[model samples]
Target: MAKKPKTAITPVRSDNYPEWYQQVIKAADLAENSSVRGCMVIKPWGYGIWENIRTHFDAIIKKRGVQNAYFPLLIPKSYLEKEAEHVDGFAKECAVVTHHRLEDDGAGGLKPAGELAEPFVIRPTSETIIGESFSNWVQSYRDLPLKINQWANVMRWEMRPRLFLRTSEFLWQEGHTVHATAECAATEASEMLEIYANFAENMLALPVIMGEKTPDERFPGAKHTYTIEAMMQDGKALQAGTSHDLGQNFAIASDIKFSNQDGHVVHAHTTSWGISTRLIGGIIMAHGDDDGMIVPPKVAAQQVVIIPAVHDEADREAIMEKCLGLKLVLETISFDNIMISAVIDDRDEVTSTKSWNWIKKGIPVRVEIGKREIEGNQVFFKRRDESPREKHIMPEDEFLGSIADILLSIQNNLLERAKSYRAQKMKKIDSLDEIFNYFKSEDAGFANIPHSLWDEGLSEKMKTDFSVSPRCLPIIDGELSDRLIIARSY
Candidate 1:
């Protein structure tokens, strides 16, 4: 038989950094540019990863008694004006629908596209609109704490969109809750922040630091904002998730209040938290390698890929039977061409090429079935991103049993690897000058600087002049350092 040449691919990290990132997204088949300039069409493979992440994170919110709901994509212009700061924060990036539709040229005559007197603005966040609903829903103390969550897409006009990192339009789940007292709202805000940290470290196998945002970094309508920041492979921090304590700003703006037991009319406190598809970007940046993407087992859509290699028809039939049988155990199973992979058993290509194919896709587990393994009544499996593939051999009957423990180990190992990197990357220092010095000296990773006073000038200056923003002003309780400001963010 004639031979086909192998396809050569460039390595990431050593390659141009941005180019490598572009290649990572493409090679992984996450998404690509659509007809629109900055918009992207998220392929199923990429959406599958998002589904895995959303499923687990959504479960966390549902477990806390937060009911799911949806709000309009476009909000009335007046709603944004309710909170002065919120409008200022999002005005520039707002995609305003000035005229819903324009008259078609004379060639086709004017088409009735649509009409609008006062065009609605696509929501950058649901705080304003959600606040309006809260005002209408709560008339008394009985409607004190109203917890609601919505899964939707939002738009932000970013100059340079990097797939999941900073896309023009992205998918995320936002939670808005109204509380009778500031204490209850604050508790809910902080609780969601912790939940985000837990999800990052455990499910996504990503390490993060939980804290409060600096003055300039606080959410537009929020009195206080909290976040979970994760450091990427390049040492840049990514704000993985955020929770904001709105206090009475939104409540007062929307006139949402309740009469207490003493007949005193009091404003409610509000909070909003969100974790977006941006997380998929973080996971790629944090856990991926030069070879390609590396997904943690818990959230990996395709946990295992089985490739059957048989010389005879009978052998192939038997192997196919075994592959079909394993479907009951795994939720997502794939048996298809590895998608342009330049490796095939029948084709004379290096086994390493085949290995790279699976690595690029970040499949958690790979099973290689061949005539030899079939004759031996066993299967040869390899764990993605794991070295020493020699340990993957098992009898067909006990294969699943033997590898169950290993799959878990891979999940745990990835989390620890990311956690240790974050701890090593964080800098705990004092003084404002020290923050800049640390960035210059240490490749500018996430800084855990402690500064006295949480004043606006100090924190706001860092944000505007420098790219650094505050992740959070963490709740220290008694151990809380005096007004110490943490400088650094995404």
Candidate 2:
């Protein structure tokens, strides 16, 4: 029998995908479980990716007339109680603060001491608290379209935590907007869903299916919820982002009333949309190989890493100089309107080790300069999107001029590869029996069925039998389609 090739990540994805995922994160030094259960400490590399995501997405929303704002972290318990459905939806996950301070116990440990008149809930989702502020901020039609976004951390007591995928605490950006009419609010929700889909595809190189959630899957207290779902390499769906059309539900709950042009006081229509750290996990699962992550160039923390291969002491200085010069030149070049970022791996380690380090970190480009390459005036490089063994050598001038194009190529390739994979895995099913049969396999992918066929009984049967649920009613072209996608998801 032919032997399996050795991979950097043991229990290669084909053998054990979940374990391989955890190993890839460890190898890349992205994040680690914290002492606090169900939480993570994102290392520099992981947080850097998030920063890039935030910076790019922030600019996109700002261009749409959305303003950045801050809201209180501790929300009054009464605020959640105001929206019964919303509170009930998140009741099990809410973490409440009942005491004001802690006092010393006889056992020499801290214990709850000063009780408060009213308890507070750590911000699970900012809808209620932000609605309270919106109620006071909007009093007339002039303040109809109040768009605001906040970058914050939220706590939801996850029963099963897995790093970025699901944790007790995670970082996210939540956007809330108030509009005069329900139609306008609905438009806002759909627009945000498109923005999320575009960002996932173009920036993160994650191809996603845009769709509307079924009634049972809609966000708590939302009139309608839209989502952008991406198919991971393992054929499971990941709901990357969501937008909710509140349709005056939150406004009525919080009393966000405003005087309309007709001189009548009425509750405002509202919308809420958000994306979170879970996206990092999606990227890893979608683009990562048996080796490690393959971050798209547009959102890569470092787009390029220049490694100096020094075999002898005499040639070290010249190679070092060339690597530094290349780093500076690469940084000056721009891709996707953002300046390229490059770093030199000059640590006292073997060249192969340094190269593999950057490869595991999923940097798009790795440029290596040794004594021979310096003398020949050439740059040898490898692309993360391609096999690690594949290398290309080009003249120094040619490499400098084409670095941006190379990065763009990597980004496009990753996106196309994922799109192709998902297309191959997706199947159109005619009956519930076929759906069950499809998922009986190990990696069943997405099953598309007519929306008319979906009913509460089928939903329950699918869930109970195969752990599958309706993903969405996919949006095709410019409109929502009758086709529904069902799958096991993260």
Candidate 3:
């Protein structure tokens, strides 16, 4: 019994987040590493969560006229060098395959052959290689809007790799498209970044600030880079995803030219947007509590866990029978297969204590079936929070409706709460000294100020002194409708 109890318990999240991270990840059965350094073996449970994200985002992308496709994993060294800036940006992080053949030495081990040809580089991003295909597929104005998205794994060899955040290899969907004109490509880039923001907010239950990346932060070959940034519990920023407008950069380099509507050959506009498995990190950091992982309702693999507390054998039989029909309506982002367990404490202690058990597991909602509610044809619902007491009972018709509404409410509240948190932490500053001062404090976010004018002189001086640059300079000039956020980013 002691052994059983030891295996069942994980640490509370209130005490420590890093320790809590280790515990919850193990308790939730997400994933862990194998023999490979900086790579993870995502358990089925973790992958199920990713599948939920992909299904939701893929549906949105499909509606926007992007079709799914597959691209090669390995790019020849020469192809990676097509766009010079891109080559320079990604060259240091690339993994190269040197030799394929191995010889059995006189000793018991096998040795790699000395003979080798040109090395192939594992792709950090598919822009250049995808550009090669675009050059061929795009010819006339008619083939101009060639939009395709691919779900694949990319290897970005990192010296220090965390599980999902900075893994050596990660899974993502990269969208590559070529348009007839630069304006359409720019629009496409912004449109996708908005989609990413919406999905982050509404579906993943994360709050984000949408902004443009400065020249220094721009994707290697991109003319302009747009990004959605999210804050974690630690007050650090995570660049959740990015969309780049290539502005004839890759098209020019790869010769992806199309005859225009005016009957003149011109470079096609190109754009690429990518969102990766690292989003799971954003979701975890944004909404997760000390309890475990507070999965946003839309992406929860098991939304509601039915924990039926039993008393007499009569109570057990009645609860088991009630749970029988529960499987029929189980198809939902929130609904898991109906579960009926008779497991009970040996001392016949109060079954109400099991509510804490479910809370510790981070189940979004727990439908409690006790004698009173079961007999009354109602079940009680419990939420995890410090706010107040909350419980409800509903008839069969209202069961699905209530759960759906509750999930949506949770999603919205999380976004609002995070937004409020960030606004309170941010202090708009006016000088370079403020930037240095803010970094020294416990408040882990931004310090430098935003300016309306693109003071080439001030920005240039600021860059040299602070080693920091403007995060976003608005393209649609305004009374600075949104002030630029200055920060040192990842």
Candidate 4:
């Protein structure tokens, strides 16, 4: 077998997967750590990609009858206490505001003042708070179904924080809905899972396995939790998205009642589902190579970058003119119904420097125009997914005509590659000892553990013994089975 070429990134993926991840973020200029502990400053380039993901996913949920709304950021401590199990689940991670003002400490510093009668907890999740609104807004069968979505920032005190994966504060979209029937709520939850899976595959170019969380892993106060799990380049699983069927737990806790068709007041069934900025982390791990991130065309900040390979100062004018013209043409091409974003790197730096810089940023395609290419009426191109050492030449007209299709191909190819990698890593194991040994291997991936092996203590033991946990249990043929998808996770 031929050895893989060395990546431009130091401490490449093969050398250290975690460090390589940080390097990729740095090389791509995506984000950075902030002065506030456990938080990050998402740079413009990073936020642009996130904005694209947000805009695309927002349309998807809206099409499914969800309407945008906003709720308070601070939840009264009593509100969280209304739901016992929910409060217990998030108590440790909740950040509380004890005072309303700051006062002089009589020294050179200031101290908290104006102590509040009731502390307000920064929302870890908004189910309880949203439930309060639902209880007040719901009055009759006419208002039985209420679906609201919020794009907001949430905070959870994390002991160990990574840039995008486990930040103290991050942005996300949460969808909450009320239904007249439990069956309808379940169906809504399932539908959202499908929507999330589709978006992950089609837009993010990530292949995910849709499944249900075990009772032990289900969201607190939720009847059931459904998730889309994807395997990353390092063979670890990442929980990409999740939807929860809250049943009547939240409705009952918040006193949300509505008149039924039969003329009796009944508690409404509710569901809450969300996808967060952690998705950015998933994208980085799932598709990024040792060189840097390979953003799918649908979610890339910039899909194409044109570089003028000016070998002679006398020819710089012509080379730059051609590059700018090609940029104009490429930007007009649309892929997946989104206009292509292209930019020309007409920097005064060396041609190799410009080419390598955009390569590190993982632009889907890079086109080089020079005097020779102009004379030949052709252009040189390179794909981010392929080795940077390799380049291809094609007629200018053909390249322009096929640009959209080429991007679509790259999107499809990334999804297929992730699917293939996951397929290679998964296996079925029946015996407990075999399951344990499977995870102990150096290159361990995912294992299908029998349902009978699960217990309340399993999660802790797996974390201690193997640094692995159950990702989800597969839902097959409209039923959830005893088989479990277990693997190490981010």
Choose the strongest candidate by TM-score: 2
lDDT tens digits, residues 381-461, model 2?
999988899999999999998988999999999999999999999999988778779999879999999888898888888
Which parts of model 1 are misplaced by more than 4 Å? 1-11, 108-115, 312-314, 329-355, 388-391, 431-437, 453-467, 474-490
Itemize residue pairs with steric clashes in candidate 4: none
Q: For candidate 4, what is the TM-score?
A: 0.96
- Give the per-residue lDDT of model 4 (tens digit) for 64-102: 889999999999999999888898889999999999999
Error of 1 at 464 (Å): 8.5
lDDT of 3 by residue, 1-490 (tens): 3453322335444346556666666666677876898888887657867998898888889998899998889888888888899988999999998787899987999988865477889889898788888898888999868899999999998998776778899999999999998889988998888888888888777877777877777999999899888877656677898999999989998899988889899999999999998988777667766556667666766666666667677788777556544433544324222221212222344655566555554556666666876767776667653321477777755775566666667667777878877777666776556656765554456442656443687577656755445666433421222456765444
Estimate candidate 4's alpha-carbon lDDT, on a 0 to 1 scale.
0.90
How many backbone clashes does every candidate have?
A: 7, 0, 1, 0
lDDT comparing candidate 1 with the true structure? 0.74
Question: TM-score of model 3 relative to the true fold?
Answer: 0.85
How good is model 2 by TM-score? 0.98
lDDT of 1 by residue, 214-247 (tens): 6667889789888887887766778899999999
Give candidate 4 misplaced runs (Cα > 4 Å): 1-5, 456-460
TM for every model, in the order presented, reads: 0.87, 0.98, 0.85, 0.96
Clashing pairs in 3: 13-290
Per-prediction CA RMSD (Å): 4.9, 1.9, 4.9, 2.6
